[model samples]
Structure formats: structure tokens, C-alpha cells
Target chain A: ENRNNVDSNFKNYLINLKNLLFIYLYQFLISLKIVFSSFIHRLIALCHPEKSIKNQIVLITGSGGYLGRHLALEFAKRNAILVLWDVNEDANRQTVEQLKSQGFFKIYPFKVDLTDQKAIKSTAERIRLTLGHVSVVLMVAAASFKAKSILDTNFEQDIEMHFKISYLSQLWLIQEFLQPMINKNWGHFLTVSSNSALIDMPLISSYASFKLAQTKLIETLREELIFNGIDGVKTTIAYPSILKG
Target chain B: ENRNNVDSNFKNYLINLKNLLFIYLYQFLISLKIVFSSFIHRLIALCHPEKSIKNQIVLITGSGGYLGRHLALEFAKRNAILVLWDVNEDANRQTVEQLKSQGFFKIYPFKVDLTDQKAIKSTAERIRLTLGHVSVVLMVAAASFKAKSILDTNFEQDIEMHFKISYLSQLWLIQEFLQPMINKNWGHFLTVSSNSALIDMPLISSYASFKLAQTKLIETLREELIFNGIDGVKTTIAYPSILKG
Candidate 1:
């Protein structure tokens, strides 16, 4: 009787193992299908140039910065109306001048610090009133990177400043601007993240941490938008490596 | 002459293609080797349980929380000294009492609001004076999760509070404690992150963003430690899914 019991138990175990193997294989195939379909969709999009930005209202934060200025010019070339925001008034004005010199007249420049929530809300309100509706927002604002050992950094000043600018500012701006996009159900949100988001490194803990936060925020926003059936609202996170200015 | 020019160009293209293929194959082999080695190392570690925590000084932040309290019990069983920090004094005391009841003696508890940098600094100083150098820092402190839509959230109060607690607190504690660990060259840093860091969803943008930042900070610190030749300083990031309280 004991031998019979052991034999039955062993047979049951083998059957359970077979069931588990089948379940895993089924799940693996499903995952592969999803990946393959997504890859094909991406390939198609890459081959077909979609000039969707033509005549769209494009808002660029940190428009005074190097990449931001060039992005502004590109949007202008694509015939998109440009709304440029920067903390530095003089530098922003210089960008405005440069755009005007290139015969891009539909450019508006605003000097606004993104870290202040109240300021962001007020400026966003003004932009909505002035420029019909913002169809695309390029979040390019970043605190200047500082190389400091974690020990050498001040908690409230250095670390908090980076968090406020890189992470919190993105939230505030998205909160202020996302409503109109949701209402329209057609908008593009692009965030410029750093390669540090993927590859961990030393000496820029504050910068890397905040950038990772920003990247994750964009991803969450994307998923939320899609899940809510707001598929027209697209999100892109660009992780660029170090740029030599 | 045109035919001859085309022929030479085609030959050059074929040679360049061969060189490109060689370069790609070399890089692919290198990457494969790295992946294989790391997989083997992980498999070995998984098979052999290393009791590294025995007799080590282990600090648990937010020790009143579900996971934190349990972790304390585990460390206590492992014969490690325990230092617990929490914003909730009553809950933290309860954890300590439970440990004591279980015959775990070397346990200390402190009430700390992690948002206040000054308070953190002072308390860390006190811990140093009392507990000696903390060998393993388990950064598990998290602001209580709140489900608020991005539109419904207050930028300054809700979002900023989460950022302060989740991100800045980690930075401050690491700053305060990292030097001693570096000096000893034998320490472990473990951060408790969330599944939200990988799979983004709605209603917890603030929490997810900060948690992602915290996760990235741990990773970067790990890399930095290794690069700086402090291999004794180990790091682990734990990403637990939803837990029933």
C-alpha cells in the first residue's frame, strides 16, 4: 500500500510539471507575439516620415539652452508656431532674435522659472490665452550639472534644487498643460532625459537621480494616457548621452 | 570612365561592409561573454546562501512600516544589531517592544521626520555617537502612498512632500552615513523600491517618480562604489509589488 501511494504521488508530480511547462510556454509565446508586433509597428513608423508637427503649436521649455535653441529652429522650419520659455530673460531674448533673423515670426518668448508652481500655472494660463492651444510640449529644462561626492553636497540646497528643477518642475508643468491636451485628445509630450537613466555612474548622483525620476514620470504618463483611451496623446522620452558644447 | 569609377566604388563598399561585419561580431561576442559571466555569478550566489548579515550593524528606516518591522525581526534572528528610525514614534516603539519580547536585545529606535534635513543630520550624529558605525543601511523610508490624479494634486504640498521624503531623505542619510562605510570599506546599502518604478500606472505619479529616483540613486551608488574599488561596499535594490498589510 505504501509503494502504491508513492507511485501515485510521483505520477501526480510529473503531471503537475507538464502543466507548468505548458503554462510557461503559452505565456512565452504571447510575450513574443507582443514584442514582434511592436517591433513591426516601430519599423513602419521609422520608414514613413510623419510630418504631423506642421502648423502645430509647439512649446519648448529651457529654450535658451543649446539643444533647446536648435529644437526651436527645427520646429520653426517645420512651420510650427513656437512658444519658448526660459528662466534667463536675456538668453531667451537672444533665442527670439535668432529665430526672427531666420524669418520665423510666429515665435513668442517668456522668461519663467519652472521650479515655482504658481509661476508655471500663471504662465501656462497666459500661453493658453495668447496661443490658442499648445499641441506639443518639449520639457528640456535641467539644472546645471554639478560633480560632487554625496558627502560634499548640501541636502536642502544642492540636492533639493536638483529635485525641484528636474523632477517637481516637470510634474507642475505637466499638471498645468495636460488638461488642454486631454480635452483635445491630440498632443505630444517629449522629455529629454540623460543616458545616466540607463547606465549608472559616479559623481553626479543628484543629476542622475532626478533625470531617472523624470524618465519614469514620462513613462507613467504615457501608460496612463494609453490606458485611459487617450491614444492621441503621445509621449516620447529621449535619453541622449553627454553633449560637448 | 564612369563604369570604372562605379566598379571601384562597389569594391570599396564591399570592403567597408566586411569591416563593419567584423566590428559588429566582435562587439556582440564581448556582450555575450559579459551576460554569460554575470548569469553564472548570479546562479552561484543563488545556490550558496551567504550569511553576510551575521553580527553586522543594521539600520532600518521607517521601521514601523509592514516590511520594515519584519526585516528587523529577520536581522534580529540573524544576530545583527538593529537601529530603527521612523516618523511615527508609537509605531516605531511597538516594533522595538516586539523585538525585545522575542529576546532580541541590541535594538534602538528614534523618531525622525525625514523631510527636515537639519533633524536628519542631528539624529544621524546621535546614532553615530551611540551605535558606532552602521555597517548596513536599509533605506526603506517612504511617504505614505496617496492615490491622487495628476490634475487633482497640489504641486507645492503633495508632490513636493513626496519628493522630499522619498528622494531627499535618502540623499541626506547616505551623505551622513556614507563616509564611515567608505572608511571601513565593508558596508551594504539596500534600498526598498516599488514595482511602480518599472511598470508605470496612474494615480501615484508623485510616488512612482520619487521611488524611481531612489532606485536609480541606489544603482548609481553601487556602480560608484565598484568603480572606486570599494567592492566591499555592496548594494541591493528591492522592488516589491503590492503587499497586503
Candidate 2:
């Protein structure tokens, strides 16, 4: 009876392994097909006329930062009305000045802190009243960097700060902007998450948690949009590695 | 000039596709080898003598709850010293009673609120004084359930509660218990995250975000342990789907 049981257990294990391999193989083939189809689509799209973003209201958070300023300039060049938000007043002004120097007159810069929910809501309200509805939102604000081990981290100061800036800010932004986009059936939501969110990295564990939370929030939002049958509103997440500028 | 540019683009696209396929195929083979090797290792491990947890101090949070109570019973049967924590006093008492009825005398139950970090630290101090050092911790405490969409959710109440229960509690538990284990070069930390952490689901977006955070925190801890060369300490994350019973 003992030998029979052992033989049966081994047989069951082999069967399970085979099943797992088959499933993985099926998924692999499907992914390959998707890649090939998307590649072909991109090639075909290159021959087609590019979609215009002219006259669209584009809101870029963390506009004073390196990447944010470049994104603002690109959108401004496309004739998109730019609403630039940054907590740094001087840095924001610098971006505005740079845009003005480049002859881009449709730039609106706001020195709004992303950490405060009430402040974000009020700023969003003011923007809606003055600038019409924002059609594109680029959430790029990052809180102050505190590289420390999880054991050495302070909960209220370090973790909470990252939580508010990386995750809650995105939540509030989506709440304010997503509904309007859903109503119009056309808008874009883009958030910059780090590759740390995908991989396990030491020293930045607290920050990575919030970044992962941010990515999950965006993903959930996308799923909700699809479930509600709203296709025009799109969400994009970029997982960039360490940036050097 | 346009035709030449198009021809060059097509050639470049094909070359990129080939490179991508090669990279993916290489990864596929590596993963297959890993799976096969791990399967063989597991089979060999089955033949080896099982490691005993006898006399090891095992701490389980949320011991009053369904899964928690059963886990406590199992650990008690293994002759491991049991330290159970739960916010519900009556439920915790019931778990203790169940253990006593089974003639298992090594049981300690604490009515500790996981949301309060101070409370957790104090309770942990008391446990250490009373029960020596905990070598294994199962963070199973779950905060109150609030099923609502992100739009209808309150940040201070629902989201914060889940954050405290699902993620913050794990962090605090690790903070209190991990170092002792690390000093001894032996310990196990286990956290229960939901399958919702992996897949996007509507309605429970807030809960899902924190669950993902909990999983990420565990994963980051594992990586940190590896980096610090703490091989004896182990971390685990469970992603269970909706439970029927």
C-alpha cells in the first residue's frame, strides 16, 4: 500500500507538471502573436497621418523637474494649452520663462503642492473654471528622496510622505480629472512609476511600496474604465529605471 | 527619399523583431530549466527528514479569526510555543480556550490593536519579556472590511484602516520581530495578501492598492535580506483569492 501510494503521488506530480508546462506554452505563443501583431500595426501606423493634439488642454504635474519641463515644451510646440504644476515657485517660473522665451504663449504655471489633498482639489477646481476641462494629465511629481533601509525609516515622516506624494496625489488627480474625461469620452492619464515598483530593491523599500501602490491604482483605474465600457479614456504607466540628468 | 526611408524603417523593424524573439526565447529556456531543477529539488527534499519546529516560538496575529485560529491550533500541535494576537478580545479568548481544551498549555493571547504602532511595540515588548524571543511571525491581522469604489471611498477612514491593517501592521511586526531573528540568524516572516493585489478588480480599488503594497513590502524585505546576507531569515507572501468559508 505504501509503494502504491508513492507511485500514485509521483504520477500525480508528473501530470501536474505537464499541465503547467502546457499552460505556460500556450501563454507564450499567445504573447508572441500579440508582439507580432503590434509590431505590424506600428509599421502600418507609420504610414498613416499622426493624430493631432493641437488645442488640447494638457496638465503636467512636477513641471519644474527635468523630464516634466521637456514634456511641457513638447506639448506646447504641438499647440496644446499647458497647465504646469510644481511646488517650487522659482522652478515653475523658470519653466514659464523658458516657454515664453521660446514664443509658446499658451503656458499656465501653478505653484501647487501635490501632497495636500484639499489644496490639490481647490487647485483643480480653479483650473476647471479658468482653463476648461483638462484632456490630458501627466502625473510626474516625486516627493523628496530619502534613501534609507526600511528598519531605519520613520513611519510618519518618510513613509507617509512617499504615500501622499506618489499614491494619494495620483488618486486625487484621477478623481478630479478622470470623470470629466469619461464624460467627454476622450482623455489620457499618464503616471511615472519606477522600475523599483516591479523589482525588489533595498534602501528605497518605503518609496517602492508607494510606487507599487501608484502603479496598482492606475491599473485598477484602467480596469474600471473597461468594465464601465469607456474606451476613449486611456491610462499609461511608465516604469523607468534610475534616471540621470 | 521617402521610399528609401520607408525601406530602411521596414528593415530596422524586422531586425528589432528578430532580436526581441531571440531574447524571449533565451528567457523561456532559462525559465524552463529553473522550473525543472526546482521540481527535482522539491522531490529530493521530500525524501529528506523534515525540519522540526518543536519548541520554536511562533507568533500569529489575528488568532481570533477563521484562518488564524486554525493556524494557531496547527502550530500548537507541533509543540511550538504559541503567541496569538487579535484586536477582538472574545475571539482571542475563544482561540486560547480551544487550545487549552486540546491540552496544549503553551499559549499566550494578546488583545492588541495593530493600527496603533505604539500599542504594537508595547505588546511586542511584553511578549519578548514573557515568551523569550519569537522565531516565527505570521502577520494575519486584517482590518475592517469596507467594499466601495475609489470615488466613494473616504481617505481617512476606509483607505487608512486597510492601510494600517493590511500593510502597516506587517511593517510594524517586521520592525519589532525581525531584528531579534536576524541576530539569531534564524526566523520566518509570513504575510497574507489577496489575489486582488496581482489582478485589477473594480469596486475594491482602495483595498487592492494596500494589498499590493503589503506584497511589495514582503518582496522588498526578502531582497533586503538577500542583500544583507541573512540566509537563515525567510519571508513569504500569500495571495489567496476570495474565501468561501
Candidate 3:
């Protein structure tokens, strides 16, 4: 009886030890997952420069909101003459007006709905004629700030938010803008995404996933473009925090 | 006329080539800067894990807005418990209620004006007593998302925002929350910063400069904490993006 008791207790102790070890391993794994994902994202960018630069034109989607306005202001101030596309005609008009007023002479806002390919194409053609060449792109502005967590968020609107704002606009812009820029010897691209792309961002799953996709696209572009003897193009992704509300 | 024209053309061609070369080098430098900055951040975190861990406990000032809310949610889910310090009582009530509903069983909310450290301390001590072990922090929730760019931003508000939100809260939190965390063997901290901390992000100059200060402090904490033997601390920073509207 004593011998049997000893064996049974030993077995229970071993099992408990095993469970604790598993928890410790799980904790380390959680940390590693975060580190690994970040590393992979960066590694893809650095390792695959060619996949990034091929056939890209600079397209700024939201040339109207405060963020868009500031971006337009910066590009124009830097003497970059390109298409400033925005669905908001008044915001677009005001941006151009403000730029001109502020002595940013090179910028001209071209009102276009970024979501519509036809509109994007028409504007791209106009850009090809006027801007001499298109090479970089910046996508800013999106659906309203519904900062509710995933549980609180309405499912339909959540799905629509990322696609309508980032993915679709970026895809159309790349098809329209980047195709021409690749023919040129150079290009650079930037997507103004949210930092939610970094990790298990709550409430902003839609935004985070798309930003992650955008960041990945840049990495792929980097890889493809660099390998094809077209080493002149580059892409920079900007992830700003929630503007202090 | 032909000989002089040819000479002028040749001179212009050489100058343009030099300019192109210079531009290429500048781009290389910019890329290097970005990579270096990220690497440095990683190095600080890894080399000084203990410090980073201990410094994680922060007292968020505006801990009530959308950004603050989401970040608070992240901290509660991933890190240990949190002491939400916000001036708005209704918001705090809702935040606490939401956290409870979400099954984060360890969140405590305090409605206190941030401008006064004494008030902050009173609530903080209560948090410290209740938790018995409070380490790891996040100072999120600030106010700066007005529709004003650099040109239109009021200088006083810009300075006031930095002083009140980033710096003052940083100081107070160090006194209240961070001190306890540092005394303990572990901590992980973060500042809800903007990507302006990286590139010459135009428009949010004042805000960016202050955030840069936060980054520097974290770096210092890493160095100081690592020099000691405790390797259970970490300080992480996020350069956030503007999520949907």
C-alpha cells in the first residue's frame, strides 16, 4: 500500500510539473510570436527589394482631410508635382486653394473617387500628361473613426471599412498609377496606415489586417522591383498613431 | 553661338548627373536611418529587457478618448491589470463597465484631473493597494487631433499639449506607477506615439518632438535597468497611424 501510494503521488507531481512547463512555454511562445511576426515583416522588406518597385506610380488618395491636406502640403512643398485625388470636391478645392495661397505652386488637386477604377484611370492619364511621370503613392483617409472594439462594432460596416478605404483604393491606384511608374527608372510608394498593423490590435481588426496587407505588399514590391534591374524604386510605409482626439 | 551653347549644355549635363548621384546617396542614407532606428529600438528592448519590463507601468492622462480606450483594452488583455486615470467620470464608468463585461477582472478606473499630481497620487495609491502588485504601464490618450496642420496649429496649444499630455503625465506616472514597477523584478511599458517619431513627418511637429522625448526616456530606462542584475523589464513604443475617420 505504501509503495503504491508513493508511485501515485509521484505521477501526480510529474503531471503538475509538465503543466507548469507548458504554461511557461506558452508564455514564451506568445512573446516569440510577436517578435517573429515583426521580424518577418521587416525581413521580407529588406530581403525582397525587387518585388517592391515594379510598375508603381505615386497616388495620393485622400487629398482633402486634415491628414490628406498635410500630406499634400508636404509633397507640394517638396516640389513633387503629382495627382492629388480625393472624392471630396470641396476639400480638394480647399487643399489646392490653401496650397496656392501658402505659395505651394506645383500642386493641383484632381478630384477623383479613388474607389472607382474609371475615375482613377482618367485621373492617371491626366497625371501622365501633366506630371511628366508618376512613381510614388500615399493612401490616406478612410471611413469614420468607429473606435469600438470588435465585439461592439457592427459586422457589415467593419468589413467595408478596410476594403473601401485602403485595399480597393490602393489596388486601383497601383493598377492605374504604378503601371506607368515602372516604365520610368524610378518610383517610391507610401501607404499611411495605422499602427494597429503591429500586433493583436483590438477593435481595429479590419484596419490592422489591411495595414498588415499593405505593409506586405510594399515588401513584395521591394523584392520584385529590386531583382528586375529596376533598382531605382523604393517604398516607405507610414504608420501613425490615432491622432489625439 | 554653337560652340558656347554646346559648352553650356555639357556643364548642365554634368551638374544634373552630380545631382542625381547626390539624390541617390541621400535616399540610401534615409533608408539606413530608418533601419538603424528600428534596430536601435530592438536592441534597447533586448539588451535591457529588465528595464523595459519595469518601465512598462505608466499612468495615462487622457485615458478616456478613443485611442486611450483601445490602448487600455490592449493593455488589459495582454499585460496585467491597469489603472485608468481619466478626468471624465462617465467615460471612466463606461470603460470600467466595458472592461468588466469583457472579462478583464482586474481593471480599476479613477476619475482624477491629471494636472494635479496629488489627486493622481491618491487614486494611484488606491490602485497600488488593490492590486498589491502593479507593474507594466501604458500612457496613452492625449489631445492633439484638431484639423490644424503645422501652419494652422496654435502654438500655445501645441506646447500645452506636449507639456500636459506627454511630459507631465510621464513625470507623474514615474512618481506614481513606474516607481513601484521599477522596484519590482518585472515591467513592460509603452507610449502611444505617432509615426512622426520616425520620418520628418510633416504637420505634427510639436507632437512628434514630444513623443521623441518619450522614446528617449524609454531608451534611458533600458540602459539604467540593464546595468542592474534584474532582467525582467521592457519598454515598447508604438508609432501609431490614424485609423479610419
Candidate 4:
């Protein structure tokens, strides 16, 4: 009897261990599935907007900068209601003018500093009120620079600029602009981001560091808001190398 | 003579035409190269870190939170310095205590409010004083629960908290920690980011927005800092699904 009991107990322990391992594996696989699906879906949405993107208001921030302008034009060409937000009023104006000449009426230019919460909120509110709903937001605005070494990098100024212009502003914009889409059961946000967030580089410490933080913030946010996607809100990110002279 | 003059004019016109065509083609090829290389390289970095982790720090931020704690432990096991920065005193203490018990003396902890510039600066300076050089800085600390929906998210508070903790903190840490690393020639900054930044979610608009912004910021930053990896510092990012829950 004692021998039987020992055997049974050992068998049960193995069974439980097997079950736990399976459960863990399942979760891991599921999470991976979700990630890959989300990523592929986003690419399709961005590259082939013509296939289908209904009831979506696309907001492209920093539409003035080289990257921002290119993305803004792409979104505009896709017939997206492009909201061009930039701190550089002149650049924003130039983009707006060019778009206007190109017959882009859906394009809205807002000269707002991404660093300022109030500015972001006000602008988002304006878009919500006027546009009725925003389905996609493309955060393509940011500060950029190059350097030989991190020691030579303007640690304070450059890094601060990255956080304010690149990182923080997107948060403010979403807080102010995204509720209606959530309620309506349809929205997607797209941002132009960088691979630098993953790998580290010498001169652009500020840029890479800030980008890394933002990446994680979204990862957790994805889990907490899975139900929200069920409500029709999807967030997407694009990490492209900078294209500039 | 008139025919000869006409021929010369035609020749000049043809030369001008060729020049214009050459310029246009060059521009087109450049754009294509930029888009394709960036897209492929970023995808490679995201999908295959081990194969491509040249000089990246491969950071895991929020090294003091519940998930951050586990991540820090994992990183430590793998020989990471365990750059543990957090706002939670107890959490940081618990992590440090636990790690110390496990024989991890290299775990570095700091109490910091990501939003407070002074705090960020001071903490950074303290980090610099302690860890002379670091390349990759993970952004892990973030405001939670109150992390609201974009619409429900407070304008001033949401942006302040998100950017300060999630975005700005990265900037400050990198500026202070990476100077020496850059001089020595390398780093990688990864984040324990959410899938939400991977896709926009409705409920956690604040989190999503901040994450999205950070994502976008890093994407652009990478463009300018490409040489960091080859020259000295490299940047890379990972968008993991929630860890084995």
C-alpha cells in the first residue's frame, strides 16, 4: 500500500507539472500569434490602404519634417484625413500648401508643440469635434540628430527634445483624441518609429533611450486593452530608418 | 549655319532632359533604398535579436515593477548589469533584496519619478556617478491604473505622467548613462513594451498613446543614429507580447 501511494503521488506530480507547462506554452504561443497578426494587419493597412480602410481618420504628427512630410503625403494620397501636426509652423505651412495644390482638402495642419500637454489636448479636441471620429493616428513627428559618440551628444538638450517632441506628445494626443473611436468600435493608430529603440547607438543616446521606454509602455498597454481592440481600436507602429540628407 | 544652330539647341535640350531624368531616377532609387533597407533591417532586428545583437544593451525597463522584477532577474541571470530604476521604493528594495539573496550584487536600483526633470537629472547624475558607462537604457517604469483612455486620460496629468515616466525618463537615463559607453564604442536599448504600442487599444488610451509616441520617436531617431551601431552605439527594439502571464 505504501509503495502504491508513493507511485500515485509521483505520477500526479508529473501530471500537474505537464499541465502547467502546457498552459504556459499556450499563453506564450497565443501572445506570439496576436503580435504577428497585429503586425501583418498593420502593414497591410498602411501599404495597401486602397484595399479597405473605411471610417478612419488618420492623424500624422510632425507632418513638417522630412519623415513626417513623406508619411503625411503618403497618408494623404491614400485618401486619409491627414492631420498634420508640427511645431515648425513654417514647415507645416509648406506641407499644407503643397497638399492644397495637390487637391488635398482632408489635410488639417496644426502647429502644436508635442511637448506641451495643453496644445496636444486642444488640437485633439478640435479634430474630434470637427472630424467626428479618428480611426488611425500616425505619430511620425520627432527630433533627429547624429553624432560620433554619446559623450559628444548633447545629453540634456537633445535627449529632452526627443522625449518632448517624440515621446511625450503622442501620449497627450491619444489621451485627448481617441475616446470617440473607442466608443464607436473602430480605430487604429500608426506611428513612425525607429529600430534604434531596440539597438543602442553612441551619439543618439537620447533618441534611442526615449524610444525604448515608449516601446515597452505600448507592450503592456496592448495586453491591458485587448478588449478595446474587440471594441475596434488597434495600435500599430512602423520603425523605419531615417531618410534625410 | 541655321541648321547647325538648330542642331546645337536640340543637343542642349536633350542634355537638359537627360539631366532631369537622371536626377529623377536617382531620387526614386534613393527613396526605394531608404524604404526597403529600413523596413528589412528593422524587421530583422525585431524578429532576430540574437543573430543581430552586435553592440546593443538589450534593455528591459521597469526593472522594479512586478514584470520588471522578473525581467530584471532574468536579465541578471544572463549577465546584464540589471539597470534597475524604479519609482516604487518597496518594489526596488524587494528586487534588490531578492537579487542580493540570489548573489546578484550588480543590480542597480534608483528611486525616480520619470516626469520630474530635476529628479530625472539628479538620478541620471547619480547613475553616471555609479555606473560610469552604459549604452542601452531600458524604459520600464510607468504610471498604471490611472493610465487612462485617451478621452478619459487627463490632459495635463496623462501627458505629464506618461511622458515623464514612460518617455522622458528614457531620455534622461540615456544622456547620463551612455556617455562613457559611447566613448568605449557600443550599446543596445530594449524595452519591456506592450503589444498595445504594437496596436492602438481603446480602453488604455493613455498607455497606448504614450507607447505609440515612443515607438514613432524611436523609429525616426534610428534614422539619424544609424552610425551609432557601426560607428559606436547601436539601437534595437523588441515588441514582446505580455510575458508568460
Best by lDDT: 2
Q: Tens-digit lDDT track for model 4 on A1-245? A: 99999998887677656645654575467556656776998787788644345335777787887877777777777777777788899989998888888887777788887877787778777877887676777777767665534434453656667766665666666566566665775666666667655433334556665565455444434443453323356666666655762
lDDT of 2 by residue, B1-245 (tens): 99999998897677656655654575467566656765887799799786577999999999999889998999999999999999999999999999999999999888899989999999999988977899999988776566666667678877888878888888888989999888988999989887677656666777888999888888878766765657789887876566653
Question: Per-candidate DockQ versus the true complex?
Answer: 0.21, 0.22, 0.01, 0.04
Tell me the tens digit of each residue's lDDT in model 3 across B1-245: 99999998887677656655654575468668777787898787687533222223444555677777776776666655566778888987777788779987666677877656688768777766755655656777565644333324343565456645654555456555555555676666666766555544324544654565455445435433443333566666777656552
* Clash pairs, model 2 backbone: none
Candidate 1 lDDT over residue span B1-245, tens digit each = 99999998897677656655654575467556656765887898899877577767898998998899999999999999998999999999999999999999998888888989898889888888977888998988887767877667665657777787877788788888888888888888888988677655666888888898888777767656654556577888876767786
TM-score of 3: 0.40
Better of 1 and 4 by lDDT: 1
DockQ (model 4, Cα): 0.04
Chain A vs native chain A, TM-score per candidate: 0.80, 0.80, 0.70, 0.72
lDDT of 2 at A138: 96
Q: Tally clashes: model 1.
A: 0
Segments of candidate 2 deviating more than 4 angstroms? A1-51, B1-50
Shift in Å, residue B157, candidate 1: 4.6
On lDDT, the stronger of 2 and 4 is 2
Whole-model lDDT, model 3: 0.60
- Residue B77's lDDT in candidate 4: 70
Give the B-chain TM-score of model 3.
Answer: 0.67
List per-prediction Cα lDDT, in the order shown: 0.81, 0.83, 0.60, 0.62
Task: Score every model by TM-score.
Answer: 0.80, 0.82, 0.40, 0.50
The residue pairs in collision within model 1 are: none
